[model samples]
Target: MTTESSCPRCGAALDEGANFCGHCGLALVAHPSPFPPGVSSLALRERIAELTAERTNTDEVLSPLWALLPLIAVVFGTFIGILLIFTPSVEISLLIFMVGSIVALALLIILNYKLVDRYNKHLVREASLRRTMIEYTWTRGQERGTTDAIYPYVSALESIDRQALMDEQPRSPLWSLAFLIPIVGVVLYFYMLYFLTRFASVHDDRWHAFAYNIHLSSMVNGDMVPPPLPKYPQERSFILYLLLTIIFSPFLFYWYFKLVDDPNKHFQEMGAFEDGFLTATGRALTGL
Candidate 1:
C-alpha cells in the first residue's frame, strides 16, 4: 500500500518508502516543512546570517592588553617609587613616591571597573544570542509539526532564559565598585568565581541541548549531519580557587587573565560551530 511521491532534489518519480532516489541518488527523508507557514527559507537564512554577523562583529571581546594594563601600571609605578626612595631630598622623595602610588592605584581601580563592565556586557550578549536561537527553533519546530520533539529543548531554553534574567537584574555596574573597599575586594573575588561557575554550568547545558536539536532538524530534513559540539574548557572549582588565591596572591592576576581569555576562546568556538551550521543547512534551505 505504498504511494508514489516526487524526489525532492531531482523531481523524479519516487517509490513510496524509498530511502534514496534512483534517478539522481539524493537521500530522501519525510520532513514536513523547512520552515513555519508564512516563513520562507530565505527569511530563516537571512536571520541566521544576521545573528552570525552580530556575534562576530562585536568588540565586546576582552583583550589581555587591556586587562593587564593595571598590573603594568603598578609595576612601572613601583619601579619609579623605588628610584625616588634613593633621591637626595628625603621629604620631596617621600611626597612624590606617595603621589605616584596613589595615581597608580587609581588607574588600577578604573581599569578594573571597565574590565568588569566589559565582561558583563559580553556575557549578556552571549545569552541574547542563545535565547534568540532557541526561540527560532521553537517557533519553526511548532509550525513544522515537530513541536512535541522539541518541547524539552524549549523548556530548557526557557529555564536558562529565566535564570539569565534573574542574574542580570542585580549585576549593575556598581557591583564592580565593591573592589574599592580593601576588605570587600576579597568578597568581590569570590563573587566573580561563583558567577563564572554558574555560567560554565548553564553554558555547557545549553550547548548540548542546542546541538541535539540541530542534529534532529538536519536528520528530518535529509541535510548533512552537523559536526560535533565544541567542548568548553573546564572552570576551576570554587574551593580550589580560594585555596590558590590564599596560597599565592599573584594567582588573582592569573585568574583575571583567564577571565578575560576564556570568553574570547568561547567566541572562537562558537564561530567554528556557526560556520559548520551554515554549511550543513544551506542545501536544505531554499535559496541559501
Candidate 2:
C-alpha cells in the first residue's frame, strides 16, 4: 500500500531523505506545516481572557478620573450659581453670574474635548490591535491549507473613525443660535442632550455621555454664562427668582441624570437605574 509523494512545485516523485524535488530542484523543507484545521478551544479561551484582562487594565487606568470630573463641575457650578443669585443689584448679579458661568462653561468644554479625543485614540489603538490579531489568525489558518474553519474577527475601523470625526466638531451656528428663542431654547437643550448620549453609546464611552449631560444642564441653568437681567426692577424679585430655581432645579437635575444614565428612562424612572451599567462602568474605569 505504498504511495509516492509528488513534488508540490512539479509532478515528480519525492525520494527518501531528499531535501529537494529531484526533478525540479525545489526545497522540500520550504513547505508549510500541516497543523490542525481550527483554533483549539483552549487557545480561544486564553485569547478571550487576555483581551478581557487588557480591557480591564485600560479601564482601571482611565475611568475613575473621568467620572469625578462631572461631579466636580456640578459642585463648583452650583456654588457659583448660588452666589450670583444672592448678589444685591441686577447689574452686579448679572456681571458676577456671567463671570462664573463663562469659567464653568470653559471648563466643561475643555474637559469634554479632551475626553472625546482620548476615547477616539483608544478606539484607533483597539482597531489596530484587532486587525493585527485577525491577520495573524488568517495567516496561521492559510498555512494549514484548510478552507472550512475560518473565524474572522475583522471590524469596520472606518466606521469608528467617521464617528470620532462627527463627535469632535461643534454643532452648526444656525442650530446653536436657535437657543436664543425661549421655547425653542428648551427644545434645543434637550436635543443636544440626546445627541451627546447617542454619540457616547456608539463609542462605548458612557462616561462622556454622563459628563455632557451634566455640562448641558449647567449650560441650560445659565451657570456657564448668565443671561441678561430683566429691564424692569420689579421683574427681578428675589422671592420669584428663588421660587423658580427651587421648583425647576430638582426637575432639571433629574432629567439630566436620566439622559446621561439611561436615556430611555422617564424622570421618575431615572433614580431606579442611576447605578446601572453606564454608572458602574464609568466608576470602575475612572475610579470615581
Candidate 3:
C-alpha cells in the first residue's frame, strides 16, 4: 500500500523514503504533528475556531488590591503600639507588640508568597502554550511547503530556553523561614526586588526578540502562518523602585501591585493575539 510521494516544496518526484528533495534541496525533516493519530487538519481547524469563538486568554486575573494586604498587619501593629502610651504595664505591652508584629509579618509574608506563586504558575502555563503554538506551526509549515520562509521562526523559537520559562516552580515553605530572623528577612526582602529586576530584564529581551522574529516570519509567509504572540513590555528599573522605597516605604506596596497588575494586563493583550492566531490557523488548515 505504497502511496506515491513527491517533494512538498517543489513538487518534484521523490523516490521511496527520500529524505531530501533533489530539485529544491529543501531538508525534508519529518516533524511529529501535534494532531492525534488518524486526525486530519480539519480537527485542528475546529479547535482553532473554538478558540477564536471565545476569549482564550487563561492567565489568572489578580487584583492589585491584594498587594495592599501587608498594610493590614502594619496598621494592626500600629494600633497595638499606641496602647503602650497609656498602659500601666509597659513591659507587658512591649512584649505583646513585639510578638504581635512578628506573627503578623510572618503571616503576611506567607500569604503574599502564595499570591506570587500562583501568578508565576500562570506565566508558566502561558509559556507552554506559546511553545506549543510555535512548534505546531513549524511542523505544519514543513508539510505545506512553507519551511523556507519559516526557518527564521524556527530558529527564534529554538533560541528560547524552555527550562528558563518553566523555572517558576512554586517556592518552598522553607523560603518563608528567611523571615524568622530580622536581618535575614530584610536581606531576603531586598533580594526579591533584585531578582524581580533581573527576571524582567532577561525575559523582556528574550521575548521581544522572539516576537520580533516570529512576526517577521509571519509577515514573510503571509496568511499561511499563525499570528505571532503579542510582546508584553515589562522592563522595570530596580534602582528606581529602591529609591521610591527608601523615600516612602508605602511605595513597596505599589511595587507589589505592579507585580500582580502587569501580568493581568499582559493577559488582556494576549486575547487579541490569541484570536488572531486562531483565525490564521483556521485559514491555513482550510488551505491545506
Candidate 4:
C-alpha cells in the first residue's frame, strides 16, 4: 500500500513523488525545474560550465601578461635612458630623455584605459551569469510547486555590483602632480600608498582584500612607487637616479601593471564571496 504526505500549505493528501497536491495543488518541492519548454538540463549545465571555464581561462592568461607589463616598460625605458646619459652631448641626452618621458606617459594612459574597459566587461559578464543561476534555481523550484531558493544568487549579484563600482572609479590625479613638488613629493608618495591600501581593504571578505593589498603594496614599492627626491643639495644628488629612471618609460609601465593586477584580485574575491553567500541564502530560504 502506498502512503500519502500531507501538503504543507493545504493539508491535503499528496502522493509520494508528486510535485503538487492532487486536491489543492500545493507544491511539494523547494525548487521546481524552470527550464523553458525546449531547453534540456544538460544543455543549461553545459552552457554555464562553458562560460565559467572561459572566464577562468581569461583570468589565467591575462594576469601574468599584465604583471609583466611593468618589467618590460622599465627595461626598455632604462636602455634608452642609459644611452642618452652616456652619449657625448648633454643637450642631446636631455632632449632624448624628454621625448622618452612623453612617449612613456602616452603609453601608460592608453594601457590604463584598456585595462579598465576590460575589467568592466568582465564584471558585466559575471553579472549575467549570476542572473542565469538565479533564474534556473527559481524556475526549477516553482515547477515542482515549491518555494524558490533565492538567497545565494541574489547576494552574489550584490557583491559583483559593489566590486564593479570600486573598479570603475579613476585613481586620484592630484597624486600624480604631487611628484613635481620639492620635499612634499616624498610625503605625497606615502600618502598615495596609504590611500591605495585603504581602498583595497574594503568589502565583506576583509582577509582577501588584505592579502591582495599586500601583494599590491609589494609591487608598488618594488616596481612603481619611487622614493622622494630631497630638496637640498645633499638630497638633490639623489635626484639623478630619479631623473634617469624618468627617461625610461618601462618602469612607469610596470607600475601600471601592478595597479591593474590589484583589480583582478578584488574581482575574484568579490565573486567567490558573493557566490558563497548566495548558496547559503538559498539553502536557508528553502529550509533544505
User: Considering every candidate listed, which one attains the maximal lDDT?
Assistant: 1
In model 1, how many backbone clashes occur? 0
Candidate 1 worst ten-residue window by lDDT: 27-36
Instruction: Give the per-residue lDDT of model 1 (tens digit) for 44-158.
Output: 6567767777774452566777667667776879887778968889888888888787777676666656655655665656666666555556555654655545555566666
Which candidate number has the best TM-score? 1
> Per-residue lDDT tens digits of candidate 4, residues 60-97?
32464655544555566887788886889888888888
The Cα local distance difference test for each model comes to 0.63, 0.42, 0.62, 0.46
* Alpha-carbon RMSD to native, per candidate: 8.3, 19.2, 6.1, 15.4
lDDT of 2 by residue, 3-82 (tens): 48888877898877677777877766643323343664235324533543454332223323444444566777898878
Off by over 4 Å in 1: 1-45, 57-67, 88-91, 167-170, 196-205, 221-228
Q: Any runs in candidate 3 off by more than 4 Å, and if so which? A: 1-58, 89-99, 162-177, 197-205, 219-234, 286-288
- What's the TM-score of each model vs. the native? 0.69, 0.37, 0.69, 0.42
Candidate closer to the true structure by lDDT (higher is better), 3 or 4: 3
Off by over 4 Å in 4: 1-47, 53-60, 63-65, 71-82, 88-95, 106-114, 148-288
lDDT tens digits, residue span 1-288, model 3: 234788887888877777678799776775444334453445544554554343334356666767667777778778777777777897898798888788778757765575546545545555655565565556566556677667757766766646456554444444445555676787776665565444544554565565556556655545533444555657788889989999999998778777666656655655556666666666655653
Write down the RMSD of candidate 3 (Cα, Å): 6.1
Q: What is the lDDT of residue 16 in candidate 2?
A: 72
Clashes of 4: 17
C-alpha lDDT of residue 262 in model 4: 55
